[model samples]
Target: MNKQAPQNSVRLPERMRHLAVDSRGYPVIATINRSPEKVDFGSISERRKLALGTFDWCAVCGMPFADELRWQMVFEEGALPAALSGEAPVHEVCALYAAQVCPFLFSPRSRLSDEGRKGEVRESVVRFVGFESTSAVIPHASELQPGIHTLAFEQRGHADEFSYSSPDELGERFADALAREKPLPVSDAEAVLVRLFNRLDDEGEGDVVTGAALAAGAVFAKDIFKVQGLGAFQGKSYPTAAALLLKGTEEQILKFSHDSQDEAFSAIGPWVLERAGRFPLALQRWRTRGNSMVKNLGPSSPQGPGRSVAKNAPCPCGSKRKARRCHPAGVQATP
Candidate 1:
């Protein structure tokens, strides 16, 4: 389900993702192959503006990320799928046509009411695909950060998608989706997510994004470092890697309903607290500049647990055993 910002929620901020072609932060105007209609100046609209969906895969075609053949730009070299929306990579044709039709490209705005959604406001992501020599965009938002205004898919090759619909045909599909509607079939994972989302609503915590973020925090604090290949991040950007892991795990966790929302929240709550406790200043800075409504969602304040958990204290995960016995080996209480 799409995340919705309430009618009175603070307005989201925005920034333009100007292409910095070289080391000098100068703007470069790159071009995608334009459609005949676009080239002939035959299209005009006074209707509301449109933008791409919030997705990791191609906004036009629903393809999952499996190989480099499918180009999705990511900020950090080792970012997770969940964090790819900041760059929402797509097919070259899709990118070119989308840029032509999207109103966001010419002028970026901080908040737009989702075309047909009554009360939800979302920031736009202006993506530029096909630029080569990939690297992280500087001063960009991390996975946990909100108000991301750009997803740069600079330089890329294409997947062996031997078939594709005509641009006119695909254009209709994109327009429909951009207008708060979908013609695509719902997948099992998404269905399960909706079921769990209903559970969240019943608990008066209806926002899917908030639930997902808190759940992600749980995964980040405990299990991320344990991933077999995560050590690679220690040399470059641990925060980016941690953000990627957290969002990726959140996607996996949200695929089904839990026995209860309390079960759901408790499952992830302790770890969220632990992360805040461990890095108050870093988290605070993320909160200050990174975009989100979840800033005030879970904890009233991100204070440490205030004291060490006794070796005899019950585990934060609510397992019926002492912390030392239940948690992974050498895990210490959050500072």
Candidate 2:
């Protein structure tokens, strides 16, 4: 008897266009088995898993990974074993899309339909870990698994806890996930500077002396300081409060410019002018004290702004060896 494939009415992502959709319009991933008119979403096809690991194919889109980093979605408890077992890795976009749309992954109320697995609870957080692909054989698994050699990065997000009864709620969750992953546009330097400055302020550092503060300062120097003009800051003196702010800002700009002359340039005039309207009294004391205040601010560190840790010194991560050799050698664990 010839059986017809289920009609796919779902609007799938571009990468998942070639995937076969189940009767419910959910795209069946590459690892799912669909044979003899039966589709088992709860189980993985060992053959397909083997092939995916061997050929470096995405488990969701079944396409070859064009980039060096491969991603895997891991539940809280299964993270360690999943990494060790060499489970199939998917493209980051594919993993993110599946995280939002897959019922068992996205919905707290959706239980596993497989027999004896119906009682499993959904985890509150889903972690996506990216690593370079390294094929290895495991004791429990018969075929080779897509083992991880070095972890590049990891991201965590809230898993949907509410039982969503409508497509609208699901779409909202999908949009939220997409928004979280989107990077800030480079043209919006003001917004980036605001965020970085806010973080620096929260750290309670009057100057960029701490390692954390220096890191943040380096970003501000590279992104915001080098491009903007500072012609409007014509104040002879700034108020005490404004003078303090200017001191820290000027120090960061000068220190960063000294460290990387080609990458960053000192421009305090524009920064002060931009804030002058909002903080009218900030520069009132600057005319009398600005030059002396800047001179007194001093350097952030003995080595300089960006070079907090020496290349030969131990990394802050607590690894015993030198930073340049030890830092790049291991997998970054999931938090």
Instruction: Name the candidate that leads on lDDT.
Output: 2
In model 1, residue pairs whose N, Cα or C atoms come closer than 3 Å (at least 3 residues apart or on different chains), thus clashing, are 86-151, 130-155, 131-154, 131-155, 132-155, 146-291, 147-291
- List, in order, the clash count of every candidate structure: 7, 15
User: Lowest-scoring 10 consecutive residues by lDDT in candidate 2?
Assistant: 222-231
Lowest summed lDDT window (length 10), candidate 1:
44-53
lDDT of 1 at 157: 38
Q: Over the stretch 270-334, how does candidate 2's per-residue lDDT look in tens digits?
A: 33334443321112322233445345443343331125567777664675777667664432321
Question: Alpha-carbon error at 60 in model 2, in Å?
Answer: 0.7
